[model samples]
Target: MTLSRAESAADHDRTVVVGAGLAGLAAALKLAEAGKAVTLLESRRQLGGRASSFLDPSTQELVDNCQHVSMGCCTNLADFCDRVGISDQIEIHRILYFLDEQGHVSRMSAAPLPAPLHLAPSFLFLRFLRLGQKIQVARGMIALLARSADTPGESFLAWLRAKGQQDDTIERFWGLVLTSALNESIDRIDLHYARQVFVEGFLARGRAFRVEIPRTPLSEFYGPVLEASLRSRGVDLRTQTNVARVVFENARVAGVSLRTGETISAKNVILAVAPHHVASLIPEENRRQDDRFEGIERLESSPITSVHLWYDRPVMTYPHLVVVGRQVQWLFRRPAGNEGYVQAVISASRDLSARGAEEVLSIVRAETEELLPLARSATLKHHRVVTERRATFSVLPGVDRDRPSSDSSTAGLVLAGDYVQTGWPATMEGAVRGGYIAAGSVLGLSPAQSLVPSLQAEPTVRLLAWLAEYIFPTRKGTLG
Candidate 1:
């Protein structure tokens, strides 16, 4: 039976959203909030997509596919949680802990100062770097802040070298943040995005540097809580529903065809899935003719590895730790109510991904013990290693130009995903922004009207950022 024949004429006005990830959820929520009929479709039985969790067959406990984190600069993601009534489920941490291989922990918290300077106080105390090294790092940051425009097709590593940043400074400071945030090597990341990360996350405001982490399992957090909330808002939520292809009429989207030989017709369709999945949905002839589909093939993905370990006793005292100069980039004490269970994540783990699971576990366990001495006394009760080979799209140099906008050449078809040009990296915030922009396009609303504003910058901070650009305005074009 056709979904169109099963509904009233009001169904014709419904906007069908494919994929139930953050992007799709955001788009559906915005459309529903606008009093527009929304039907959300997900091929998976559960929601949240990559930011999801599943039952461990051996332990029968919930484990996330990855460790998802948010920062103070992620206003759109915070807004989405607020709108969905899960704001309280997120725990805000003012202090960030960084642990060295020798188990020396350095605490980083903002001081009661203005933007850019707020973090300066704590940065001075980091035990990982020497005083001379910190001064050099500070100079590199000033250069990063002062630059006005991006050098097209330039890697951040090249830009960093041009600023006279030493190799030690790049690895100890710049690589520490960009590798985890962008999920790509510093050498491959675009300079434009690396600058955005620092300016918005650290230099914009004092509060923008704070961290936000969920206190519950992703499956429960997104499954019941978000599902109920979206459904309550009159959204037709369907899981385990797959769309075979988008049916177009005269180069316009009329509806989507299901794998089950059924069709759901709609006037507005938002393709919120990954870039690779997108081309298969649109007809070959249309994709060949559309500029929106161009260059999508050039977009590549990065990998992330998460290692879950359950010790016989509590080994980690801190809630989380940023492991400096180690293959295990970030470690989190699992919030799944399992005592002694913790997860270690390695982003941009291409080298590690090629290793066997046992080898990966061994490396992670050794690193954890080295960083946290208490782990040496604890017994490994159980363990699991999960590697998402295609975790996020690589924000490579010149890749932003290939990122299409929300509007498509095919009428009534909108695009939404972290891969879109959301002016942010492949993060939850970017996904939410993409969804809002796509929904905004459908409603004919401006980006300002549809999306939440970024954290306000201090007056002096704005002036400094502006002055830097004004002084170095000729830093455009290709940088060798």
Candidate 2:
């Protein structure tokens, strides 16, 4: 039963997008908003991908993959949230609380000072880092500030050492920030992304470091709410539809084949799935010649462990706390919801990934009770540990050259994921950026056309940026 020429032409007019994760959804929404016919296919009924949430059958409670926080610097994520009308569901915190190994508390808030010195008052008063360590950190920042751009292939640790950063600064200060932001250790992260985290997230503006947390579970927002919103925009959102392989005709992407043996042809296709998944789905011939697609094999992944605990009573006063010298890197208080639920995040969890759930919970529970004063009084109820082995693609040294562009060599195909060359770490911001880039490529628009403008740089930070620019006049990479 051959389809008529008109029918085949109609099928070719459609645009099919694989993987309804953040990157895919963002691309779909943008295309739909632009009046393009779009179809999004997802393997799971739910959305959000790596930053997704799931329901526990026993307790019937919803849980997120981990605590996904958006810093004020994440402009694209904020823009996407605005588009989806979920921006209000996120709470932006101006102050960040941290506890040292000895359980000493410190608060990080912007001071009255402007720009580069805005956090000076708060940072100077931090009780954890010694005075000398602070001086050394400041000096390192100066070195980082004076330096020009760094190659994504260069090692972050090597750069830090060359900048005269001490072990204490790396441990107490740099380590804490890098591990959380990069989702990889300082030694494993690339210098370009690490410095971007500092230059954009920290030194750009006072509020750049402000943390944004969702008021409710991620499933509650990205699930029905987002699906309905996308549907309203005329997107053909298909859930529980797994794409088995990409169909090629005449050396171009003809469409995609589903596991159900159904094939949907399209004029344009965006492969938004993970890097590892792409090679399997792509045609063998395409894999053989395209070095970009072949390089997906070389990219490594890092894991994140999230421990959700139900306590008898409220355990923490702060919404979230950054922990130093502990296996649990970050603890987020979930608004005392449903019997005081708490989430602990361990980024780049190499050492702990091999441990069993019960064992990890036992060790983390004991440590949590000891660290927070309020936790000592609250009795532990139930705990569930969620571990994502390939939570994010590690932005390792010398890996940037291997990252594929949004527009691949394969005709009628584009790519979108946190792994794409989004010029950022594998955060929600990067995913959104990837989608925007892919959408732009599909629409034949400029790279900057679809991107949201970055938050404005303050006057104080502008001066420091000016000084840094003076050192390396060609280095004018600012926020956004």
lDDT of each: 0.87, 0.83
RMSD vs true structure, all candidates? 1.9, 3.0
Worst 10 residues of 1 by lDDT: 471-480
Q: How many backbone clashes does candidate 1 have?
A: 0
Error of 2 at 406 (Å): 0.9
Error of 1 at 287 (Å): 1.0
Over 354-473, each residue of candidate 1 has an lDDT whose tens digit, in order, gives 999999999999988888778889999999999999999998998888898888777889999998878888998999999999999999987788889999888878787678665544
Per-residue error at 350 for model 2, in Å? 0.6
Off by over 4 Å in 2: 1-10, 147-149, 469-480
Q: Report the lDDT tens digits of candidate 2 across residue range 280-307.
A: 8888887675667857788899999899
Which sections of candidate 1 miss by over 4 Å? Answer: 1-7, 147-152, 467-474, 478-480
> How much does candidate 2 score in TM-score?
0.95
C-alpha TM-scores of all predictions: 0.96, 0.95
Considering every candidate listed, which one attains the maximal lDDT? Answer: 1
